[model samples]
Target: MTYRADPARYDSMQYRHSGRSGLKLPVISLGLWQNFGGTRDYPGAMEILGHAFDAGITHFDLANNYGPPAGSSEELFGQVMARDFRPYRDELIISTKAGYNMWPGPYGEFGSRKYLIASLDQSLKRMGLDYVDIFYSHRYDPNTPLEETVGALAQVVRQGKALYVGISSYPEAETREAHRILKQMGVATTIHQPSYSVLNRWIENDHTIDACGELGIGIIAFSPLAQGVLSGKYNSGAKEGTRAASSNTTLRASHVEPRVLEAVDKLGAIARARGQSMVQLALSWALRRKEMTSALVGVRTLDQLKDNLGVLNNLELSADEIAQIDEATKDGQMELHPSPKGWLR
Candidate 1:
């Protein structure tokens, strides 16, 4: 089928600037972290991509390490780029990251200049792209000199391989330092990716959110649904194939304990009263911050994706609603590994 985008694609979608940069990303971005990998159905992935774009989602986020076999997600997305998106390349904001282990040995991961440079080349090759709109250091490397890591990002921009650079899961001090280092190199730390949701509030407690806003670094929140905890799907219990039931998933069965389900019930009640689903309520809460550029969503089914996009129906959160959410989730904690050196999983 010839993929012609919806003629009215841009009519209802909203865009927000990444920090103070001129680049505007859709309020909701599709992420290729899970279901777009090689193990999934290729045609189904294409259908999701096609529909996402038709709904005015202009940003697609990926990482070099985003698959069961590692790099498979990028390879799958490369096919989509070659087939359906070549004509609309300039209309998209494609971003990829390095800094996780992609291969073996010393230079396989981290913030080394060698690893970043080599990784970007390999990523570009795998994705069939000359450059990514935004390149990110997926995590902070405590051992590597921050300057060395950020300097490689600057080099890629000058070399025309990446237009903008960002950092993810970096603490407040490191984020401030990365911005300063990039500024010295005549580059802006355009964005930050972090795990943020109504249940997980590390960014808020650790002051990472405040730091990005103060530094003019836009935040694109991942895991806004808290690994399905906020989706109200687990109020009864973890189903047979749910993420919490999977041994390899980051969301453990233990994380969805009785206390957590209780919080979900309270949150769901608040959402239903306002005529919004639990997922949309979670999204609305995450995007309530002005510094949030987009909320990155990973969906396995087209129906799930549509449910997430239903957030467009009600985007605003009143002060009272915000207060209610806070009170309900005050004691809620999803056992996550968040720190200055790493982010929540």
Candidate 2:
């Protein structure tokens, strides 16, 4: 059966301005990073996405190389958009990225003008859209000159292929440089996508958050759930079939160590005091930041989306609760900066 999102769903969502830009993004955005990819479940993805829109999620994030088969997520999402979201196209904020490996050849990746332009064209084709609301350079290409990359992004804006450009996973230094160059080119470098969650504090300590606020760049934090680590779904001695059960090179089976799980347990206790789930506590914490325009997360099922949306109903975090969480993870259970590996898909 086809799903039709309720028009009244938008009433509960809070939209915040994207930096100094006129655009306002939903407080919670959906990201097609893992489950939407080929390795995960399809029906689960559809249910999650459908429920999210019905619960007032206006922004959906994607990338060229998101799926195991590369571009498969966008292709799948294109099908969903055609079947369900076609009527509400103007009400959505869709974004896709390039700069990571897409195809097999050298021209298939990187931030070169040739690669950027061609990749965007291919992404638009896969998504079945003429233009993406926001396009991102997935990562910094040290091999490509910053000027060349920024110029290509500006060109895309001028050509109307994308309304805005954003940078992801760039170091603080490179991010500042890119911001300068993009502004000089007359393109509003509206947003910066970085990883931030209770487990990942690199943005806070590394000045990425402060710099973006000072420069008027809105921040949309990706992986704010820490790849599902902050949801109280996994424990140190958890049995198989959990998120930490799979042992991959990027996120080792042991990454969910005893210390990490211990922190999660303690945090769960704090959440109980507030009458919320651990995931809701984590999402609400991310949104409390000044530079944070939105929290980008992935959902594997409709139940997860509904649970996550409940966080917005209670955004109040007291000073004592904040200090308690700070002490619980004093050693930092998960390190997000200079990420030891990529666990996105």
| RMSD, one per candidate, in order | 1.5, 2.1
Which is the leading candidate under TM-score?
1
TM-scores of the candidates are 0.96, 0.93
The lDDT of each candidate is 0.88, 0.83
Give lDDT tens digits, candidate 1, residues 120-190. 99989998999999999998898999999999999999999999999988878888999999999899999
Q: Give the C-alpha lDDT of model 2.
A: 0.83
How far is 96's C-alpha from truth in model 1 (Å)?
0.6
Ten-residue segment with the worst summed lDDT in candidate 1?
Answer: 336-345
> lDDT by residue for model 2 over 1-345, one digit each (tens)?
777788788889998999989889999999987667666555666677877888889899999987656788898888888777888889899999988777778788878999999999998998899899999988888888999988899999999999999988777888899999998989988999988888778888889888899888899999787777788766645546555554431354434777887888889899998999999999988998778899998776777888889998898788888899999877655665643133343
Clashes of 2: 0
Where does model 2 exceed 4 Å of error?
39-44, 239-241, 245-250, 339-345
- Stretches off by above 4 angstroms in model 1 are 245-247, 335-345
Give me the displacement of residue 299 in model 2, in angstroms: 1.1
